[model samples]
Target: MTGKFIVIEGLEGAGKTTAINTVARILNQHNIDDLQFTREPGGTPIAEALRHIIKNGLDNEPLTDKAELLMLYAARIQLIDNVIKPALKAGKWVIGDRHDLSTQAYQGGGRQLDKTFMVTLKEQVLGNFKPDLTLYLDIDPEIGLMRARTRGELDRIEQQSLPFFERVRQCYLEIAKQDRTIITIDAGKSIDDVTKQIEQILTKWLTKQV
Candidate 1:
């Protein structure tokens, strides 16, 4: 049987990390063998290092939307070739905490990066690497930002203004509209409620596939 690729996507503080962890635990309890959980920009050393640099806002000059888009894809190439693909080949279910959807949302919607440019990059650089399922955690930008701020230090990206976050949220919604494989979840709900919903969705999908 082929391995399944599932991705969890959301803005910062949308509870993506918690959701992914909960889902992983559920899968383990069910004896779903050969499962691996990872996050983007870094799943391996090189990609993770790149993630740190980008997240920390290391680039001296103002990071243009185009530059940010390219960096994201750069990390994606490394992640897919080195981590995701290899794990899939080994018949493992790879659950990514985030994926290309982030690039399209943050770069395209948030930064006003061109969609045409993203498509071009996807075709040439990313190739056939696509998630089987994408779980989008939908939350209002204001609430998300407040939660993020309350949590602690904000990353360069997270520190972006409210308008930027609004754009990002819109991007996520747009992607959900465009793709059938994407599932939108109301992240405004309580964490347990959100986890239950995700588990139900995963169970249904896994049952069908298996």
Candidate 2:
């Protein structure tokens, strides 16, 4: 049997890392031992290189919007082919930090790229592949940015204007609204509270799956 693919999505500083760990713990409690964890734009060797370019601005010039979008897809496909697909086929669960939703939010919404075009690219690149479940942590852009700043220096994508992340957050909400597989969680709450909510959601979903 093919294993399930789970993804966690959110804006910067939305506690995705913490959420991922929480999910892993929940899965472990259910005896789901064979698992793999991946992060977008950097899950494999080639993907990691592309991730560096995408996250670090080139010295000569800023990366073009179109180029950034394509690179994300390229890295994603590489990770899929080399890592995620194989693990799933081998019956190992794959937990992902970020996925195609990020493209929809960042490039399509924030950059104001054509949504139709973004959908077209997604279809071409991913076809029918999608996460079995996506946990989306929703937070205000200002609060998220403040938390991000406390972490360290912001990366290229993290350095985007407040308006950009606002648009991104809106896109995430809109997409989550239409997708049953995507569960939205209020990430502004305390870590323990967020963890409790996530466990409830995951437990309920797993009960149905079983």
Against the true structure, candidate 2 reaches a TM-score of 0.98
lDDT by residue for model 1 (86-187), tens: 999988989998999998888888888777878999889977768999999999988988899998998889988889989999989988999989999999
Q: Residue 90 of model 2: what lDDT?
A: 95
The ten-residue window of minimal lDDT in model 1 covers: 57-66
> Number of the top candidate by TM-score?
2
| Runs in model 2 lying further than 4 Å from the true structure | none
- Write out the backbone clash pairs for model 1: none
What's the CA RMSD for each of the models?
1.4, 0.9
lDDT of each: 0.86, 0.94
lDDT tens string, model 2, 1-210?
Answer: 258999999999999999999999999898888999999989999999999999996776879999999999999999999999999999999999999999899998899998788889999999999999999999999999999999999999999999999999999999999999999999999999999999999988888877
Candidate 2 backbone overlaps, count? 0
Question: TM-score of each candidate?
Answer: 0.94, 0.98
Could you tally the backbone clashes for each prediction? 0, 0
Q: Name the lDDT of candidate 1.
A: 0.86
